[model samples]
Target: MRIYTRKGDDGTTGLYFGGRVAKDSALPTAYGTVDEAQAFIGLARAEAEPGSELDQLLVAIERDLWVLMADLATDETNRAKLVAGETLVTDAMVASLERRIDDLSARFTMPSEFVVPGGNRVAAALDVARTVVRRAERDSLAAAAPGSRVVAYLNRLSDLLWTMARWQEGDSLTARAVAPLAGEAEKGA
Candidate 1:
């Protein structure tokens, strides 16, 4: 298995299930943007505190993104490989993200003005990741070419990231506004 297949030298590449398309094809763009998102998450993770929750969340998100890439990698013949990943980027994922955004918001300060994108290395890196995520969402939607659930997921994910950044910046969201913890109210009382 040589890495240099030279098949893509002519501005074309093979998909996951023996399908060939242009390098800039929609399928590639969709999955390729996912790859980009994962790379940015890696960078952000490296810059984040070693054991911070944000760091951990990014790790999980990156893992999910790999699954997403697999899902997006359909062959040229529309004969997809067994993707193994969650074929649907479900509403639950979106809800989970909203919960996370709320959790971070509860402990941070909300911002009204635009952010400068640099409170620390992690923050800066996260900002970069957020932008890339937005771009990925755009590209993914373009590739979807219709009302796609995955595209909607990406859009929400980007907003989640933006809110997460602000949350990291000390914008505190209320506990009630977020998902209620199992014993949080009891503890507070």
Candidate 2:
């Protein structure tokens, strides 16, 4: 059980199965981004109002992110066979996030402007989590197999992060500017 197997000294790492891959492989990138999101989620939880709903929800998010990281750690074939029944991220997970997002977004004014990702410590960390979640979404999409749920979870998780930040911090905390995204309005339309 030595921590140093010395196997990855040359930029290669072992996966859950017997397979190995380069350190910079796509699966790792997805997991790394998810890990970054989870760390930022932890930061938000620590800074949020103690025992509040937001803090409780973030703790749940961190647990789900760990599950996502585990899925991404394995190769596609082994990932398909993983038997962690309740731990798997699912469409119902996406629905739960939607409920949370809608609950928070109701307090905010929808905008076509770009807002800075800082205000309160919790909010800022949540914003960081949002961007990392976005990266995780893209990377997971790239890593996704035909029936994978990882990418979808990341997509919804990022949206949840945005609304959670606005909830924990006031909407006015987000700065005003032009929209960074084009055709964003049309998508909502």
Candidate 3:
């Protein structure tokens, strides 16, 4: 009933099914980063209109992160216990993200160059989430099993986050849009 178990005080944390590992171990690090990304996604969701498509989509993604964290938290010994689309990352999940990315990308004029993040509050939050998702993706690589789809899911999730941020921004400002530095202009002259 109480939240604090005082179990992790020893610097090790419990996995989903069973077993423990250091708090800084690869699986914990990966899932912890996924938790962070989910929080930022919540911030973006809060900024969206209630009942809006963006809000709904963010809610779904947030729920998916729970499944992802569960997948990452389970050790290889208990890997067989994971349920696809529930406790484990599934191909359907990755494909769903890809489909959303394509749909959202179709709604906007894709920027030809790198984008500056702060276009608006929701978009900015989405951008921050996207970056965290990227970090999660990298971390998952070290934690994932050889045939695990966790890494693939994180990879596609990051891409979907990028596309969502762009969709929320309406018009993304590309890196090329920045004015030349005064000294650079003088040097060119």
Candidate 4:
């Protein structure tokens, strides 16, 4: 099959069901951001240690993003065709991210201050992926339709990526700065 259909030469793209819309429309913007996030996640996965838990999790997330893009590409009229756990984003998908975050967050001390991203190659790549996921979350919210669980999924995904970045960095490698309590330091003296 020829990759170039020449159908979008007029700056319009096809929706999943049949209709076409401007390439810059809300739906495409949202899914395009998701695609960007998925690519960065791939980069992070490549940087992860071979056979490590981080690598495994990134692979799973990449698969999930494909489902998310499909859901986003579909028009609201065609939403009934979306199969949960496959083409559709579901509550369980978001819950799974929360569970993973909780599991990983338990392994490290919560950062008391802003973390300066970039402790190592893998961690830095994960941080970049996390930021892109944040953008995707915002775009998803804007493009959301009734019966769409994509917003919830993207929301939890950003949280998961943030937690994973911290998990990969651990305590020793995480760059953090803390401020002393107002008068506590003087009182101690």
Candidate 5:
């Protein structure tokens, strides 16, 4: 099939269940940001060791984002057509992220202050992915339909990504001094 449909050349995009909207509309923006986040996650996955835990988690998260995108793409009028665990972003999806966050965060020393977002290649990439997820979360919140769980999922996802980056960097996170990890410097002792 030809990739260039040219259906969107007029600055409009099609929705999931028969409708169209401006290309720059909130729904498209939200889903587009989600797509961007998924791409960054893919980049981070590329840096991870083959079949490692981080690699596996990133792959799963990427799949989840596709479900989020589907949820975002569908208009409210077509809600009944969406299948939970497939096109719908369900409560369990958000809960899974929370569990992963707890699981991963338990393995790392939580920094008391903001992270520097760069330590090693993989960690840095994951940090970028985390920020992208944050942006996606904001966009999704603005566009999400009533009772939608997309925002909640993205919110937890960013937390998980942050924890994953710290886990990947390990002690290195404590060393990277973009702002000094917690109170280690003591400031002119």
Candidate 6:
């Protein structure tokens, strides 16, 4: 089959179980941002040790994003077609993230101040994914159904990403200011 269907050439994209909407619409924009986050999570997974816990966890999160995107892509008309934990985001998914966050947080000493990213390549990639997830959460707010859990899942996913980055980094760098050089101090005086 040809890769290009030319369906979206008209500036509209297909939805999950049915219908289509403009390419720039809320659902597409939200799911597109989620797709971006999933790619970054893949980058972090690549940096993680093969078959290791971090790698395995990232793989799970990446898979979950597909479910999330499915939830986001489906219009309200087809909402009844979505199955929990399959094509829809569920409370259990958010709870799982919370559990993972607690577990990973317990494995490390929480930093007292705001963290600076780039503690390591894997951690830095995770940090990047976390920020993208934050954006996805914000975008999902506009696209989610009244009682949908997509936004909650994205919110918890970001927290989990932050915890994972800190776990991988061992010692996270703080955003606190450092002492100035002697010449700078003299100039100030």
How many clashing pairs per prediction, in order? 9, 0, 0, 0, 0, 0
Q: How many pairs in model 4 have backbone atoms within 3 A of each other, for residues 3 or more apart or on separate chains, i.e. clashes?
A: 0
Candidate 6, which ten residues in sequence have the lowest lDDT sum?
A: 171-180
lDDT of 2 by residue, 1-189 (tens): 887989989898887655888889887777878888898889888888888988899998888787777777778667656645243567777777788888878887654545566757888988888998898898887766567678878888998988787776674554544444568867877
TM-score each candidate. 0.77, 0.81, 0.93, 0.90, 0.92, 0.92
- Model 1: per-residue Cα lDDT over 1-189, one tens digit each: 787978889998776656678989887988898898889889978877788888889887887776666556655245233433364355676677778777766666676455666655666677787888888877776565343356766776777677766656553322224434669977887
- Identify the superior model by lDDT, candidate 1 or candidate 6: 6
Higher-scoring candidate on TM-score, 2 or 4: 4
RMSD to true structure for each model, in Å: 10.6, 6.1, 2.0, 3.9, 2.9, 2.8
lDDT of 3 by residue, 1-189 (tens): 999999999999999999999999999999999999999999999999999999999999999999999999999999999999999999999999999999988887888766767778998898899899999999999998778888898888888888888887785444237557799999999
Model 5 lDDT per residue over 63-134, tens place: 998889999999899988999989999999999999998888888788887777678999899999999999
Predict model 2's lDDT versus the native. 0.77
Which regions of candidate 2 deviate over 4 angstroms? 84-87, 108-112, 171-189
Among residues 3 or more apart in sequence or in different chains, the pairs in candidate 1 whose N, CA or C atoms overlap within 3 Å are 105-173, 106-173, 108-170, 108-171, 108-172, 109-170, 109-171, 109-172, 110-171
- Model 5 segments beyond 4 Å from truth? 176-189
Work out candidate 6's RMSD over C-alphas: 2.8
User: Higher-TM-score candidate among 4 and 6?
Assistant: 6
lDDT of 2 at 49: 80
Per-residue lDDT over 1-189 for candidate 4, one digit per residue giving the tens place of the 0 to 100 score:
999999999999998867898999999999999999999999999998888999899999999998899899988888888889798988999899999999998998878777777867788898899899999989888687776889888888888888888888886554455446769878887
- Candidates 3 and 6 compared: the better one by TM-score is 3
On lDDT, the leading prediction is: 6
The positional error of residue 22 in candidate 4, measured at the CA in angstroms, is 0.7
Put the candidates in lDDT order, highest first. Answer: 6, 5, 3, 4, 2, 1
- Per-residue lDDT value at 118 in model 5: 75
**Candidate 6 per-residue C-alpha lDDT over 1-189 given as tens digits, one digit per residue, 9 for 90 to 100:** 899999999999999988999999999999999999999999999999999999899999999999999999999999999999999999999999999999988886788766777888999999999999999999999999989999999999999999998888884344334456789999999
Q: Could you tell me how far off, in angstroms, the CA of residue 109 lies in candidate 1 after the best superposition?
A: 2.8
Report the alpha-carbon TM-score of model 5 versus the true structure. 0.92
